[model samples]
Target: MSSDDDPPESDPSPHVTAVVLAAGRGERLRSELPKPLYSVCGRAMASYVLHALANAGVSRAVVVVPPDGRGRLIEQRLREDAPDLNLCFAVQQEPRGTADAVLAAKGQVHTTQVLVVNGDLPLLSAEQIRPVLCHDHNDAVIATAQVDDPAEMGRIVRDSQGRLVATVEYRDADPAERAIREVNLGLYVFRSDFLWNALEQIVAQTRTGEAYATDAIPCAVRNQSAIAVEVELPDGRLNVETPADAANAEAVIRHRIIDRLLDSGAHIRDRNAVWIDAQASVDEGAVIEPGSHIRGNATIAQGSSIGPNAIIEASTVGRNCNLESCTVRGSVLHDNVEVGPYSTIRPGCTIDSHAHIGTHAELKEAHIGEHVQIGHFSYIGDAEIGARTNIGAGAITCNFDGQSKQRTIIGEDAFIGSDTMLIAPVRIGNRARTGAGAVVNKNVPDGGNAVGHPARLTPSRRAHSTTGDEL
Candidate 1:
């Protein structure tokens, strides 16, 4: 990533196009949703693969999908999530093997080098891809991983002269072949010309009756044109096929997200308990406590401390803010704001700097100015309050009238006594005061005082309008 003043690299991106294989129907997972659309941690499974390609500097991609209604739904979501990437869709007309799936993307292939990736690998990273694409002279680059038990994988084959040869799947291999620890992860980078030529010569196996993409290795090797480069990834592939696999992949992604935050100097109290979504951002010096769920474009700025237990969704918290035991959604809290112990701030709310919302308070569609203090056990909805206003405990803004909602305006330096209820379409002027347990239904002019139920004007030092005139 370039700094603010750094000069941009002329072509920092690699000159390779990517084709993501996503036509697989994962019956093992036993879910109605498509495999590519399955939720992995906080995002769809295929989105991680697309992000890896983008981070690896692959500018354009073609995602292969089935020609079904589900594919259209997936396409809509992909466009919404990744609008910057130049995405094109290719329909795999039927259920086929890897080689046949690659052929579906024939029309979209334009670059000299092509990266073929499995869409199920949600844990794929750009660092794991660079080793394969970095080899300029290699005809093909295969990514392999080492596992303790190499079951249900293709073992890498070598010749007598210790040269790279082919990959033999465990189902078709003999005893010795299945023992090899290094297995193919079904990810490859290939030269465009060799990819097209080698895939055409593949013969379908009798067991599956499908043309395997692995057959390309032996074809290239037999021609004495195979230059295979292998990369052994440390994290391995997080491909999901079953329910258990989905849980494991979700755990891995959760760790990865938290680890990235820790590495960037964010303080998290308990690493295992917090759930930070894929797109959430926490600045340096921010603190995230245990049992917090941060999701959907949530950003915690520097010097902010959030939750021992809280949920923040699609909200922004400014610097030096503090929140605890609260849920905030689609709202903005400015600098030095203090919310919660137990509060719910809903959408379309703006809390200005130095405002304090005490415990058990809720605000929806409200604009609160600076230094305003709303005590505990209150509900303020569809209201606008000026700066330096002190709202008493158990206050309620009755802004809803069963048919339509209305707004209330409270001016600066106004003092409301405890348990006061301000009715809809009401205005309290600057320096106005309300008595305890007052049910206010009319506007009070500047320096006016209201008292009792269906409140009447109280005696004041300066004369003021008690005629409920709205400014």
Candidate 2:
């Protein structure tokens, strides 16, 4: 029979159900969060795997997560992040073997064949995944890797005819099996019925109290089923478990993102100085100075200038924003905002048009409106400054108490002097003024002025607030 006339060897509807095993606690990662939820290049580590599977024609998926609050959170996040992909969740109530995890999603596996992928392999791609699933075999077709050191991995034992016989674990393998360089990479494609039968046989072996997927391979081989090994591309298999592995995965992802950006018409003056992600966009006229790293879905609009030494991540910079020698992340800047030689714009900041963030200034979760000026050596966090406001040198909004956070609001056309400190949950109204070395703890009404450590109000001024407030 022709490939199409035969029973569906692979998913023909561009819809294969993927079983992603993410039930492990990943204790070696040493994080409170699950390893799959950890980031790689800008996205969750598991997201890359999901994307690859989706691209490889898996329309639906059942991610097997641990029975914990973290796992539920991961499922929710994946749903929100990749809404286009039809994804479901399956709970592995206990720490079981990989085969048990797959069986947890047995109800969801309706396709003729199922694609099983490891959650930790962040570098795997659709091109590599598709070929393994396309193999026409009555038995399981596993993606295998030829590693230099196969000491820890399960050995892929093949017969003289080069048909895969079994996968022997390192501890159980004989010397002859130990010499094989081909190792099971934990990615596989199996005929649905054969897989179900193998899993049933594996569960019957629970007398040992530990059920393993590798055990199923031997069962299939005993039944005279064909087990084949599909060699994977060298660059496709990277398993992240420990911190060192995470670091290596990060480097690999970084290189991939950089290469993709370069191919997409992004200019890097010095490869060492610049780190741009695959998803970030930089116009041709935009100049990314040396020692600048733009990461995590950030975009530098046309005519924008990034630092001689700056880092920007998970943020958006509009046209002509002068970001020189600063670190910005999870912030948004409108057009023509000037961030200076030494500044840190932390997460949740929104700097409006013509705002000036000067040298040594640090802002976190603050909103600086149009034409606002935040001068040197100031710290503004959890604050909202209105249009045409002026924040002087050495001024700080004390946002964090010993226990919690607070907010500071400066109204339109407000002028705050040097060495001023605004404590939490405070407000300065429109056109308010503060004298030099003022410590503001209370709200100042519009067209008012204040001075001293515990700031007091001054007489109203009809004239508009100018100078330090203007861009």
Candidate 3:
């Protein structure tokens, strides 16, 4: 079931291939993580660029990764994140420049054209790139953007006719060349045949003697085959090279998501403080309070109110539900469910409609039926509670007895009194009742009443107060 909330991985066309350069190890980010692995708005950096490639009708995507564990990690993530994009991982044997990375994907570059993109541009979107990919006049179209600081980025050089003449690399550019505001953003659409022919001509290396992709553009312009188009991206097409760059990129993405959510009818008390992952869904009329962190594939349906400091990851929240400061991970809550000002619902738990989980209650691998009420300070794990069951405050389902977990089953209309402990592998039948502070270890038959530690079951709904007999 694919929804708009999932990662934007569209089906690619069969005309052109995208060569994504992702082999760099981000030393500036100060983590052992490969640059492409850096997360922005809860998604890897490269996934956004690849999504743009797919959305722009690229035939396939060839991700260039380093040759090691980092490469495998990237490959695995790409496989999961953008499975719809016909993908191939090509290993760049060494940390190299943009030209070398493109060359590495030679095996998959069988199309008439190739779109070269930097993997770190987390703000890249398909709408910002449609024109460049659709340009068919020149042998290649260079993507240029105006930046406040052109530090270390290639400057787009244009001829008198306003056509692209060359891309002057920062390391080799003189004072006049360095003053250009329109700089190459490292995104290009090239004729595949021309690119192959030009790549072989790029023997000139940079100061560190690495093959330079920028150097190829000047020779290409001399052949009158290159044209540069300046496009203004809303987020300025940030190239995330350092930790600060990563932060800026995330800020831009956060604003984008928040604004889109607000426009889509999701209300947030404080948009700046909330962090909703790109893949998470907040339907129309959903109210998200400040300090809410919704991540992964979590979905909050219409009219639902979540958080003041809640964490929901990979969970489904049905319509009109109200959730306070709770942590729900990999759980499902049906319509009208009320969960906590402080509750934890762990993986594999499913609560049916109108179920109420009180403050500080926790549930794990529990199946709760409609109209069920779990009181405060209760722990229901590896359990199944039927419809209309009322679990009193401080109740505990002792599902794990030091060795392994066991099941506790409570039937329909059952009333579990306060502070009761239902031991492992136990069953309380329909309309059953448990006295306060009772510890029931054995099965209580239908309509039975349980009282005292190692509770003894009686025929009546409760024990006789004075006689204390099992009437």
Q: Pick the candidate with the highest lDDT.
A: 3
Question: What does the lDDT come to for candidate 2?
Answer: 0.77
Q: Tens digit of lDDT per residue, candidate 2, span 1-471?
A: 000001112334353577888887789899887888877666677777887776666677889998879788889767755624578889988876888888899987787777788887877777667777666465666778787766567788887888877888889888888999888877777778888888877877687655866566666677776566566656534677778777777777666665554555555677665666545667656777888888866888877889888998879899888999999999999999999988999999999999998999999999999999989999999999999999999998898778899999889998999889887777788888888888777666677678876876543442333433221
lDDT of 3 by residue, 1-471 (tens): 112232443434466788898998878888777889788888888887877776666658899999988899998987777835788889989766777888889887888878888888888777657668777656788888888878788788777878887788888798999998889887888888878778766744345646755556766687787888788866755688878888889888888888888878888899887999877889988989999999887999999999989999999999999999999999999999999888999999999999999999999999999999999999999999999999999999999889999999999999999999999888888888899999998877668889988898654544332332222
User: Which residue window of length 10 is worst by lDDT in model 3?
Assistant: 462-471
Compute each candidate's TM-score over C-alphas. Answer: 0.84, 0.83, 0.90
Candidate with best TM-score: 3
Per-model C-alpha RMSD = 4.1, 6.3, 4.0
RMSD of 3: 4.0
* Model 1 misplacement above 4 A: 1-13, 31-33, 67-69, 83-85, 135-139, 161-165, 168-177, 197-218, 224-228, 441-448, 451-471
Query: Clash totals for all models, in order?
Result: 0, 1, 0
- Model 1: which ten-residue window has the lowest total lDDT? 1-10
Ranked candidates (TM-score, high to low): 3, 1, 2
lDDT of model 1 at residue 82? 69
